[model samples]
Target: MFQYYCGLRSGVKPNPSSKRSSFAHKISRFLKCCIYFFMSCIVFHGIIVLYGAPLIESVLETFLFAVLLSTFTTLNCLCMLGPNIQAWIRVFSKNGAMSIWDNSLQITTMCSIVGAWLGAFPIPLDWDRPWQVWPISCSLGATFGYVAGLIIAPLWIYWNRKQLTYKSR
Candidate 1:
């Protein structure tokens, strides 16, 4: 089922002529998605560390946070855009004009980042709650933001679906 959804996002139309070929294609795409997911996790981990996440003091938490953030952004984006760097660039770096898919990616990415940023706020506060630990609050915030994006992006696209016209550059 997940594979089917991924295939749809990556524009893998069903080939009525060959079930064997279709199965092979889906397996290959699924593998590619897994690879991209893990690679993005590592990249996000390094990025988080650079952004002041602890390396020596709390490696596990940092890595877990990376996984959480990656799940929100990288995994979701991969499912939407596949492994095509060109598609990523087109959606992420091009003009504001976008298809529903591109807009969804942008919204999800922004929400996750903002969520993580906002999550860090309580860390320095003197609230002294158990959830105030380094990345706990941030993770919760990111998760909430991601959920919000998932909800809002669709509604936003639906509300504006007719107004925007996306052209391939």
Candidate 2:
């Protein structure tokens, strides 16, 4: 019984599945993701600055951390089980191919951006309280928007799946 449990029965060895990538490969891919993350952060921060959002003493630091949140939201939406950065990149490309997942994520990302922008409106109201800081409202909005998107995505995909028609590329 002990030998059987230990798999010592007949010169048998447990082999890992071929579907998994090697650790080295995953690390390399993750490093590439890091570079993309940094670049995207700079771009997002620059746009925010250009739009005159706020002038925090630590604006760069704030953006550096906020980009992490944004990336996490976007990437997880695109590929929850196995993250495909390339797939997310394809969404921004011209004449890009679209799948149900791709369509859902793209819409979700846009909704999140809009939601975040909308969240800022409440800050200027008569409620002069403590939590009305710049970008905080926007961040909260983005978070809520992403959650809403997550909730809506499955239903959207399921409802539209049958209606989706193929087009000649």
Please list the C-alpha lDDT of all candidates, in the order they appear: 0.85, 0.64
**lDDT of predicted model 1:** 0.85
TM-score of each prediction: 0.79, 0.68
What shift in Å separates residue 84 of candidate 2 from its native position after superposition? 7.7
Compared with the true structure, model 1 gives a TM-score of 0.79
Candidate of highest lDDT = 1
Off by over 4 Å in 1: 1-22, 165-169
- Overlapping backbone residue pairs in candidate 2 total 0
